[model samples]
Structures are given as structure tokens and as C-alpha cells.
Target: MSPTTLPDGATLRTARPGDEPGILHLIHALAVYEREPDAVENTTDALTRSLFGPDPQVFTHIVERGGEIVGIAMWFVTYSTWTGRHGIWLEDLFVDEAQRGRGYGRALIAALAALCVERDYSRLEWTVLDWNAPSIAFYRSLGAIPMDEWTTQRLTGTELETLAATADGGGRDV
Candidate 1:
């Protein structure tokens, strides 16, 4: 796909192989922005493996201005049974602190939404932390409403394995 221009003149495009390092930098910045600097568990090698591997499950779009990556949107596709269609589940949306309020964040989201429409996806969705008032407000202003009726659930690490083992006919070998 060709480059798309953001409101502030930044260019947005799909990430490529060499962009992994830049994407990792943004991921680290995002972790710090979210007040969990130590939570970034993926290294450059890991990011490259998952994002550029043969069977990449996640995707990203990078926004750059003046030869530097200032923002990124990381996401994956999900299916909505009721809608009978696939939708985008945005995992991360980050704009460098120095670039905030320049329309980068909104541009990233809008770009993704456009992709959803282009690909015939049902919708684009993501969750914002309850304490992130700024982000919550920004999302609300974009007409993205909260799923107040639903609660997100997740199981990771050993818990996930343990839960899966239950279906192995009481075998904990896994």
C-alpha cells in the first residue's frame, strides 16, 4: 500500500522487516507511557520473530515525520460470531510523548479504521486503561463507546496451561 498522510503531514504505512527496531523502540516508549516500563517482555529478536515470521499473527502501521517514526499501531484480527465477520483488535496505539497532540494518535486510529472498512471487517476495537483519562477522552471523542455490558477476560502463563490441561482428560503432562 502507498503512504497515507496524517493531519500533521506525517506519513503512515505498513511496517516492513527493517522497521522492527523502530517498532520495538515505540513499544518500549508505549510501556513507559502506560506507567509500566518494566512490563515490556519482548526483545527485538522476539518482535522480529512474531511480527515478521512466516505466520505473523499481528500487524502494525508506523507513522513517521521528518525521517523518524513517531507513532505506531499494533493489532490483530478477530472474528465476531454474531456479525459473522472479522474485526480488528488493536493491541497497541502509541505516539511518542514529544509528538502528542499533533494528531498522530488520531491519525493512527483513523488509518486502522479505514483498513477495517477496506477489508470488510466488522469493526475496530480496543481497551483503554480506566485511569488513562486522556486516552479515554480521546477515544470517546472519536465516537468509540465503551462496552459497558461486557468484561474482558484473559489467562496467561501457567494459569493458561493449567486450564488447557483440564481438557486433556485429566492429564497434567502438558
Candidate 2:
């Protein structure tokens, strides 16, 4: 889709294949905000491959102010078997340091919410770190609630690889 210009001299638009560098730059900004810059495992090539390659597994939207990318939001569709419909899981949202107070963050999220409503998505979800007070407040202002009953868990390193390589313990390394 073509970019949509906002009245405030900014634009909101879907990401394109040519936006790899800009997206990666914002990804780095997000990682830094999360206090783990070195944990970003994605490079521009990796982002381009994952976002715009043959499979096109993810979607991103960007906010540009005065010709510079000021914010970004990346999301993907997920199925909620219990709900039996598709929902949007926002994987990352970030506004550049210098642009934080300019309403770019809210505009990015509002655009995403607008899309969710337009597409009839069953839900729109994202997680904020517990210590991120600013983000938590922002989310609360948007009427988002904490999924208190759910605890997120994940397996990584050896455990993940082992599970991937093994079956239900029949001949799989008991």
C-alpha cells in the first residue's frame, strides 16, 4: 500500500523491501531501549529476508517525519485456537529517542489499532516489560490490560534444539 500522509507533516505507511536499513535502524533503537543492544540477532539482510523475501513472514509499518523514520511497529498474525480466529501480535514498537515526545509512538499504535479494527482482527496484543513504566502507562491509557493469569515461558539453547530433534521418547534420546 502507498504511504498515507498525516496532517502533522508526517506519514504512516506499510514497510517496503527498500526499507530494510531504516527498519534495522529502528530495531536497534528498540533493542537499546530494552537495554540489550547486543541481543539483537537481526541484520539488515536478515530483516530483508524475513520481511520481504519469497515467504514474507512478517509485516511492519513505519512513521516518517520530515523524511526521516521516526517510529516503527512490526506485527504478525497469530491464530487463537480457542477463539478460532486470527489476531495481531505486535512484536515490536519503537520511536526514535529524539522523537519520543512527538506523538509518533501513539500515532504508530493508533495506526495499528485502526488496521486491526478495519481487518476485524480478533485481538491486538503486545507485551511491555514490567519495569518499563512509561510504556506501561501508555498502554494503560490505551485501555490495555495485563494478562495477569498467564505466565510466559520459553525454552532455548540445548533444550529447544533437543526438543526439535527428538520425538515422544520412543527412540529419541531417553
Stretches of candidate 2 off by over 4 Å are 168-174
Candidate 2 has its poorest 10 consecutive residues by lDDT at: 165-174
Provide the global lDDT of candidate 1 against the true structure: 0.90
Give all candidate RMSDs, comma-separated: 2.7, 2.2
Q: Check candidate 2 and list the clashing pairs.
A: none
TM accuracy, model 1: 0.92
Q: Report how far residue 23 has shifted in candidate 1, in Å.
A: 1.0
Please, what is the TM-score per model?
0.92, 0.91
Candidate 1, 25-113: lDDT as tens digits: 99999898889999988888888888899999998889988988889999999999999999999999999999898988888898899
lDDT of 2 by residue, 10-31 (tens): 9989988788888888988888
